[model samples]
Target: MNQTFDVQGMSCGHCERAVTQAVKALDAAARVRVDLATGKVQVETDQPREAVARAIAQEGYQVAAA
Candidate 1:
């Protein structure tokens, strides 16, 4: 499934990497793209939306409603 999330508190490249890594930890084949300026994260993964959101939350980022 493909999901787009409004992710807050991503200020730099490290934050981007952290979010990507966190999702990848859940699904190794997942594809993650982050737009820091827009605070949007577009992910293509097999995992459910809730699981992905929780992973982002666990990474210390807020996942806004889609």
Candidate 2:
């Protein structure tokens, strides 16, 4: 499944990398793409929605909405 999350507090390349790594840590094969300007994360995984949200939040960002 593919999920798109509306994230907040991402302002640079480092922020994007953080989000990507956090998501990948949960699912090694998961594909992550972040849009820093829009604070959005696109992930491909079968994991639960809340799991993904929590992973992103752990990276110090707010998961706005789906």
Give the range where candidate 1 is weakest over 10 consecutive residues by summed lDDT: 57-66
Give all candidates' CA lDDT scores. Answer: 0.95, 0.90
Candidate 1, 1-66: lDDT as tens digits: 889999999999999999999999999999999999999999999899999999999999999856
**Residue 11 lDDT (model 1):** 99
Question: Model 1's lDDT to the true fold?
Answer: 0.95
Task: Kindly provide the TM-score of model 2 when superposed on the true structure, using C-alpha atoms.
Answer: 0.94
Q: After superposition, how far is residue 24 of candidate 1 from its true place, in Å?
A: 0.2
Provide the lDDT at 47 for model 1. Answer: 96
The list of candidate 2 runs beyond 4 A from truth reads none
> Residue-wise lDDT of candidate 2 within 1-66, one digit each (tens)?
999999999999889888989999999999998988777789999999899999999988889666
Position 37, candidate 2: lDDT: 77
